[model samples]
Target: MKYSSILFAAALVFLAAGAAAAKVPAGLDRIEHIVVIYLENRSFDNLYALFPGADGPSARTRWAPQQDRTGKVYDLLPPVPDQRFPAALINAPFLIDQYVPQDAKTPDLVHRFYQNQLQINGGRNDRFAAWSDAGGLVMGFYDGRTTKLWAYAKKYTLADHFFQGAFGGSFLNHFWLVCACTPKYDDAPEAIRAKLDDQGQLISDGAITPDGFAVNTIQSRFQPHAASVTDEARLLPPVDLPTIGDSLSDKGISWAWYSGGWDDALAGKPAPSFQFHHQPFAYFSRYGDGSDERRLHLKDEAELYAAIAANRLPAVSFYKPLGIENQHPGYANITNGDNRAADLIDKIMQSRSWKSTLVIVTYDENGGFWDHVPPPKGDRWGPGTRVPALFISPFARKGYVDHTPYDTTSILKLIELRFKLKPLGSRDARAKAPLGALMLESK
Candidate 1:
């Protein structure tokens, strides 16, 4: 071979060696089961604000003062509508437990896509209190160290810099959790399309964007949704994107989405808090109502327990708790939800799969709550505010605090890495898997 040809071959060898050296963290292949325990609506600051050795807030933390819609800075926070807070309060993050006990519920905040973007305020993260319908409550957080899950976190790995995938509420974030991409509503009616002000902030929240993206909550086209059968226009059109479930099934890997209240929802007697929009797979055409895949993969929360007890858990499982135990504000209290999550973890620890399983506990979104750290910019969709994400496994680094920048799709990336599956989109394609939190070469 010529000198140039030899040099080309040498360079190719060098590149290939580098790629091989960057393999998935050691011992990852041993994780046969990954359970993603997806809870609802809480920011990192809202839940883990007082966690030791984590990037939590303190009394001396500087806060960005909130500005009203007209760009006027607030001298005092607007009074909370519930009259639970003191009449006058400074414009900064406060301990919610000081007013409402950790066991109590608070009013829901506005967590729409456009509003979330506006609240982020170009990453300043100062508009939450201003844009929130619950007013000053947006800046409130609990002393999370008192929660039952805190003990689990102390025993495992806590990811302080993790973010939710999408820039909105549970609906879009749920879709991102499965697909790492936004759902489309290409021919949505104008009435439901969001109306934005000149500054690109939402004048009124809508289910679809002006450009035909479903960034907000909309009833699924499938059965068990709130929309009437005749109200086709009101329902979100069936999405065509491939989800993590699809990818796993294509590879003959077992997986299931076990949701609380799913069976009841199908029986047309859904709990009052059974949010139809939270079911991401129900909107996909492949999982259409009565589809065999739907029957096989979409299961009830009780099935998760049975599977755990029987050691019959799938390779990958996504578990969504019922609203009452999901830690969502407005209906769910933090204490009950935290206790439920701890109990679930306890049950899983006692299961046969415990030795080989990886359990990821995280929230769906910030739920319109405020956080100190701004999300790293990604695409037009999100990586919204910071949400609590933790790693629990025998292989997980004991009592470690992982500051690696990760989003909700990082969980999907972890699964993809373990299963050797291709990423569904650019978002998860670039997401850093959470393998760094695990012990390498344990075998």
Candidate 2:
């Protein structure tokens, strides 16, 4: 057997053993709702370097040292000025604590699919700077002491080993979050297909280039409207993949994907900040425009707040904030996203459903940020770079750290097991369910 196939088979065995060993918590059925608040960009180390008891980068802990293009380690990283706001950078990875003030945004880094693979560099993890557009900034870390979300982590369950499911950017990872599989464009046009070299690295401008890693970000030929043609590559064609949403519906379990600025974006409003690619359900056939499933399952963020207030949240809910509040570098700052998330958590806690709710706060992908730990060996797609995942519930072990390894598909696994739904038959089937000591009480 091929090496990768052997590894995959071994992984499946491990997952099966893990599932068999973990008994479903007795009171899991009492947890009637699962709320997934998905933020954007930032990696675990980028935002939680100081999170207590978590495996994070530090002078003593594993350090994410920067490397130049030539693979030489940089004693001190050079300044990476934002393309839009070149003057904002402070020349190095400065401590972004409460004392530093938090109005400005950092420049965005390249988090495309191929670039991530290059950064991972077969688990060497020393090529972040050599493969990045943001130079040494790829090795940056933040002080968790400044953030409200960090406080939430300290007060709740932080899964130190949680990772983004796929190996790419927000678009594909969002699909992984719901579907646990890569979106496919059968017989895609040559223009859209990534050009790869002998070693499988992306080829661009007649040469293999690390900077030309656009594996799946091409514009879709099918646009929502005429004006949407401006960036067709960004929109993926509608897919027919079955999602966790479909599974929930099959079991008659209530669910919704609440996204910020959904209505305006569908209306063809320019830069609506709705982020079309971020809406994974919108690209699925069942939830296509004008479909009844779309109307019932997809909603606006405002509706989420209303639902919380009215205590009418569904059994499964996924919330995506607007661009400015998403904590994505280049446009949004971490402070804004952290504060908004903290407030949202506060509101959720205030709701009557808090006692029965298990809220998961996580990110879509690493967003080109540096993390010291290498991702686990899974399939060709991933268990990508480590991202922060917080389990917030009345039953969650308070002030505890969960070291159990989990990918984005793990969320789907938990939901599937809890609702007695069939597996999606991809990573979700083999992924470890969030079981064991994560909960404080059984019954």
Q: Each prediction's TM-score against the native? A: 0.92, 0.87
The 10 consecutive residues of candidate 2 with the worst lDDT sum are 205-214
List clashing residue pairs in candidate 1. none
RMSD of each predicted structure: 7.3, 4.8
lDDT of candidate 2 at residue 105, scale 0 to 100? 74
1-443 per-residue lDDT for model 2 (tens digits): 01123443554464445433233446677789999999998788888767878887656765445566577776665556543323344323445432234557777898977778778877767777667777666766777676788877888888889999988688778878897766555444455556656665467421112222223544333324336356544345677767889989987999999988776766667354556667778778888778889889988888999999999999999999988888988778888888878888899999999989988999999989878889998777777899999988887888988988998999998888788776665478778877642663553
Highest TM-score model number: 1
lDDT of 2: 0.74
Candidate 1 wrongly placed segments (more than 4 Å): 1-23, 197-201, 227-230
Give one clash count per candidate, in the order shown: 0, 5
Model 1 error, position 262 (Å): 0.8
